[model samples]
Target: MTRTVLAIDIGGTKIAAGLVDEAGTVLAEAVVPTPTGDAEQTWQAVADCARQVLGDTSVEAIGACCAGPVDIGAGTVSPINITCWREFPLRARLRELATGATVELAGDGVCMALGEHWLGAGQGSEFMLGMVVSTGVGGGLVLGGRPYPGRTGNAGHIGHVIVEDDGWPCTCGGRGCVETVASGPNMVRWARTQGWQAPDHADAAHLAAAANHGDKIALATFQRGGRAVGMAIAATAVVCDLELAVIGGGVSKAGDLLFDPVREALADHARLSYVDQLRIAPAALAKNAGMIGAAAMALRADI
Candidate 1:
């Protein structure tokens, strides 16, 4: 029988499980929403999904990724969005269903980079960055053709990169972070504060629609958001000599609504010779990047 691994992605909005082969193809998969409740309730929801996908398949190992500020050394995760789990023992708990297979954990940003490096938009790029722009902005690095988790496993966390000197305070306790302007919720919040007329429970999608119809405030909101994202990308590209950046997530679906400003900002800020070579592209794997990336991490014997 061919070797296979169990892959799981735990996000604030949803949880996904699948059986993946060594080549990054998903064999079996399942998905469930992240329920509203405490830690154990979320765990049970994930467990049920994993079992549904596992069924009668046997795997040699398991790979899991989550929204993070994760501690791989301690097998724990403390995602900003999932406040219920603060340093929760994730790898250890996953072991309960491991059936003796080894379990590995990683932050979602790192997984996105790994997956993109292996089979998505990052193919053939030796030095690159993978980013997810959603409720929050996330990023990871691929250096020398391998995933580089950095000293604390959050090396390429590009979202937290400070873009404004005295701008909005970030949830990460920083000031003027790229996330402050570009994240989905942040964009909506900013627009509302700027006199946008949002309906009840409006989200980024709703804001995009308003912009599509030529709402001046809505358009300005995305321009500001894109400017922040672009400036950050330009800084990262120069610092790391990155050749490409693969972007994915809910907010990324805004297409050129978000990217045009990003490109303009890049052209304005990245004037260095090496930085001029950087290319920005959309992610090809979509929501499946995290799962494939988790599997890629597990397949590595050298860690």
Candidate 2:
């Protein structure tokens, strides 16, 4: 066995693939913009990107992560943003692509947790939560030093945790979800409603820039988001007894602008002693987390 795996990270904005070794090093990688066209276009992009990394190389296993909610049993994924791929037969397609190799599948949130647990800020913690704060909010749990993907393979999904009773509508159908308050798009949407002076088509990065420049509304937006996320984290900690939370993804790049408030909110609602013990840290692996975590799944197929 080569001890290498083809790792794929499927997201709404991009599809990434990497050749990852057992030690978690990405020897080769490729990326492609997720197509806005039909499902076939998206699948072609994924296949091409994976092939770009693979070239002639063959691996014994393939580990794949997609934005959830995923049915790992059915090997199907229905990423909310990528509407074209509802119940897409991802694993079967991958299997067809690789004749002899085995394929492992997981939600991106699960992969994020697993990656952090394997070799990131979550190291040394047997029970932790890995959260990705980006265009969408999602999280996963590492319990007993292993990823705990529940029955539909989307356990520890903290985004759906309701923060406000009737604040904003979420893609998940529920209103006032933690994601409504904290996810990048929702944050920007909230900022817009508050009369934030923003450029046309401004995103979370733009909002972060305004916050860094001392824009009060923008700062307040981060605070609101952080508060929602922190409250959800505290809730999760109380329930799961998590030791730490490693947060990553695009919006987390805002640094202390986002983290300071998260810490403050975590403190505010940390009613229980065990919940107060939880720590929140930024992801150390940058953008490679999901792919690395997918590789981690391939490394320990039985887990």
Candidate 3:
């Protein structure tokens, strides 16, 4: 019989759940807006979504991906963006919801990398990094064709990697991190600071639209963010000897406005031949990468 796993992705803004087969096919899925009230409310939303998606389906295992930092051993998570979830016992709760199946948890970035490695942009690469550049930045790595969650399950946190010695403060209690320079909100803020007039509900998409329309300030904003991301990728490539880097999340939808400068900056910063050969590409599976990755984790315990 074919094996199936329950896959769940938890983010600050939304919660998603799905039933995935061993072949990376999503049999069924559901999404719900994340509640901002409290931890229990958020947990309820996740549980409800999972229950709705699963219905009467039976799965062999359950896999969950959430924002970090995660304690894989303790089966807990403390996502920075979700304020109420400091040291939340996510794995236990998921296990409770799923009843008899095995439940596993990892950082969202790791799941993304594993998902891409199994079925997306990083499919053929032996070593790869996956990054999410949305409200916050996160990353994961795949080495030797397996997801590497590191000791604390927070290995590929490239966003928190200090890129600027004296840059903006991060929620993670750090300064000048890549997130300060490259996240969607920060990029939009930088553009506004440079006198870019934006609509009342301005965001990265709005900024991208302006950039596409030849707005110098908006264009400069993307370039600045892209360079920061490129620098992070270069550093990671040098350290991890990554063969490919796959980028996803909301801001990555900006197309050439983000990628062109990222590649240019990579060329300028990565002097070593090995690092220079690193290829970066947009995520192939788009929004489903996390769920698929989560399923990969559940199905392959070795990962």
User: How high is each candidate's TM-score?
Assistant: 0.96, 0.97, 0.98
lDDT of 1 by residue, 1-303 (tens): 667899999998999999998778899999999987899999998899999999988777999999889888898989888989998999999988767989988889999998988899999999999999999999889999988887767788999999999989998889999999999999999999999998879988998999999999999999999989999999999899999989999888989999899999999999999889789999999999999999998887743
lDDT for predicted candidate 2 compared with the true structure: 0.91
Model 1 clashing residue pairs (backbone): none
Angstrom error of the Cα, residue 29, model 3: value is 0.8
TM-score of candidate 3 on Cα atoms, chains taken together: 0.98
Q: How many residue pairs clash in each candidate at the backbone level?
A: 0, 0, 0
Whole-model alpha-carbon lDDT for candidate 3: 0.92
In order, the Cα lDDT scores of the candidates are 0.91, 0.91, 0.92
Candidate 1, TM-score vs. the true structure? Answer: 0.96
Give the per-residue lDDT digits (tens) of candidate 3, residues 54-116. Answer: 898877699999998899999999999899999999988988776788988999999988898
Clashing pairs in 3: none
